[model samples]
Target: MPSVPPFPRASSRTHSSPVYRQRIRHTVPAAGCLAVLLFLIAFGSSTVSAQPADPAEHVSSTEPSTSSLSSPPQTIAFTGGAWYDGTGFVNDPLYIENGRFIAERPASIDTTIALDRHFVVPPFAEAHTHRIDQKGTLEGAVDAYLADGVFYVANLNNIPAFANPLRDTLDRENTVDVALAHGGFTSPGGHPQPLYERLVDRGIYSDWTKEQLAGQAFHAVTNSEELRTAYETIRADEPDLIKAYLMFAETKNASGLTPAVLAELVEMARTDGLRVSVHAQSANDMHIAAEAGAHQIAHMPPMPFQHDDGEKWYLIPDSTAQLLAEREVSVVTTTVLADGFDDGERKERVRSIQRENLSTLHDAGVHLLVGSDTWGTGQNEALYLHGLDVFDNQTLLRLWTDTGRSIFPDRAIGRLAPDHEASLLALTCNPLSDFTCVEKIDLRIKQGYVIELPPQTTSSP
Candidate 1:
């Protein structure tokens, strides 16, 4: 088996519950078996099995059949299209088989797909988004993402109780892959607490009690001991990443984690073997998060200093940009969601600040990952439109493909290359020329499975 980092020793308090002990026993062995099976497959061994078998009786023969050893690989080829393989666009045919891209054509062809003048690019990644709904199925959200050629979605804010089951359902259905930051670390009455209260008051999750809501949505750490316990509790759910919220003190009616507490939380999460993603809206919060060793900035931070002449323009300081770049921390651009501001002037100012900050970060060599922070609906297209104001289509494509790959290095999702998953989007026109062409998605493929697009309705004349 491939070497893995040692699992952290859990405290007796962490495994105090019978249910927790049972989960550990079941999940650990299953995960270990999976790792061993994957290792065997990688090394070209046929000892693994789908079902339990007697190891001694199932030994492979030294002399294998010639036909079995020499059989040609199943091939599927796509002709007449330009492929954007993360770095550049190449006008050539691409081939795939067994859900992976092959360098050369196979001896025999199993299927051939004609692209005719379309642009084939890697499937998009929704790197930032919240829970689509607090109740019922996530089918609407999942379908919306898939329709927009987003095969992988990183749900930045999620309740473990809800996200875990939803992830399993989506995996079983083979619709979309979801990476969840199950809940987030925040102070009592912080950003999400107020938001969660509104959700409950609005009857969105009326069935949930206040205690349950707090348990699912907010970690609310006040001190070191609480911070440690929060880490253990959240880690027990096995989230893909950890999310920490850092709100400025100037924001009225909201409480937030102090810098010291935030730093401690980040350190504890890293020690537990999780990447820390922080939500920082203000410039100070952004600096604090970066200095605390966060792996990613979940949103573009607002500028700390504003012009006194009533101008909306704001610039990120060169020193802050350098710090982020030096740490190699990526920033997920959610500037598109600036439209949510109630004041028009405030909205414009925030947008201006985000654009300037994004430009600075990009110039400073910081990785910029594309994220919509909006629900997985028609908003996917809106994200592309909004991003055009700051980055060109080529850079935007890279944010979606190359930068996204860095977010999940173990998964083969965001690139068209050998040994990568056949997840891609076929656009009617080249997006590099006009980013708006993203809306004209001709087809979507996930893991070599073609997703049938919904038929368009014709209006009566």
Candidate 2:
């Protein structure tokens, strides 16, 4: 057992200077194998010790508590593997027990199942996936992630009602590390207005083509009281973090959250101990969110807003960079999301916008966490392609795996250190040397159970 869990708070940490990434190190827990049907059936359960019932009944409580408690949770160990060691990825032996890494060495491990001659990377995490839950049927789409080495997620807005079932599965089955947001905090009319009926109307404009929604982004919040109430309602769900809505510049009818209102929402969330993430479409919204002291800003500001008052749209301005550095606002670089092409011209525009923003922020020491929003295809998954130029493959893999560790400070997940989560993916070639190697997974081990596919087999139907 670890003397204590790492609690560095991976949300985002501002650095004094730019730092390149290293490889990933972690053990696969049951959470990593949620999609592996074979693994679940073979090693679904884990046993955690319980306090003795009473001195008279159990005496010293030293019976090891085997029976009644169920089988121990499965944990996978990757021996003779190379992965990120925080500063970079390296080849090393790894050991994991009960979903956590307990040890790693330079030589062979005594385990029967060895991950020799494989490139083990941390289980990938889609930081901004839509909400998912288990229905009664075993054939559900929830496991889509585990099949892809996704152990953790930052869920987008979904019904608060279904959080429990997913949480139960994650807790009991060790299937996923899910951090959900209450249904989105949007302007009176935004993305939610279309996806959800109650949220529509108020000129949210559902009739728009997919190109419009994709270009426009989510709704913008106009009313301060409504923003306050919405934040409260979502906070009541006890989410790991808060989601905020910023307006699209084109939606003049959609009044963006003013600095005061954004501050109000931030304050309310503060009292309740919630971190805020803003879906800012422009720089003004981005500024409001930062000024309000929100913890995480979800996107890279693309174009400059260029308000009549000289305010700009979305961008990581030098001033904003300085401010973010000062206030510690970590930006989730979802560049992959920009891959959507309205057409040849629009696709080029969006891609260009993302590239500009990304290069600037990266150079500015902004806390850049690599996320795809990929699980749902909002942004495609990262391997050697897509985000390669902006973020090197090695850097992307490291941040995707380690940065999602918003819960702990550089936990065992991001590095191949002893006593970390044994959640790993093995590649045919060294990804550190070439990011594309990640695209060629040779083996995957999540919490002691293999998905049983030839390195390239599908984990899903």
Regions of candidate 1 where Cα sits further than 4 Å from its true position: 1-74, 132-137, 249-254, 303-314, 376-388, 454-461
Q: Work out the TM-score per prediction.
A: 0.77, 0.69
Over 4 Å off in model 2, which ranges?
A: 1-78, 104-110, 131-140, 171-174, 198-232, 248-256, 303-312, 374-379, 383-388, 407-412, 447-461
- Candidate 1, which ten residues in sequence have the lowest lDDT sum? 34-43
Give one digit per residue, the lDDT tens place, for model 2 in 1-461: 01111212211111112122212222222222211111112211122122113222421232211112212333333434445555454554555554566654323221223334455676666566663532332123334454455566776555555454455444212244667765666655455555655323333333434344321233345677566555555555667777776665334644445556667878877888777887776765666677889877776655222222222354457777767767877777666554443355555555665666667766777776655554442224464224547776555665666665763333545555566655567665566666655445544555443433222223422
The local distance difference test score of model 1 is 0.62
lDDT of 1 by residue, 1-461 (tens): 11112322222322122221111011111221211100011112231122122322322332111111101123456655667866556765566666678678765444445555567788776678884433264655555565566666677877777667554355311355677888788888777887777776786664766668665777888789888888788888888888888776334633567778888887877887788888876665667778988889887765222223233223567777888899988888776665556677676676666777888899999888777676643235245435547776677777776644755768776778888876677776667776766655665666654454333311000
What is the lDDT for 220 in model 2?
A: 42
For each candidate, the alpha-carbon lDDT, in order, equals 0.62, 0.51
User: What's the true lDDT of residue 297 in model 2?
Assistant: 75
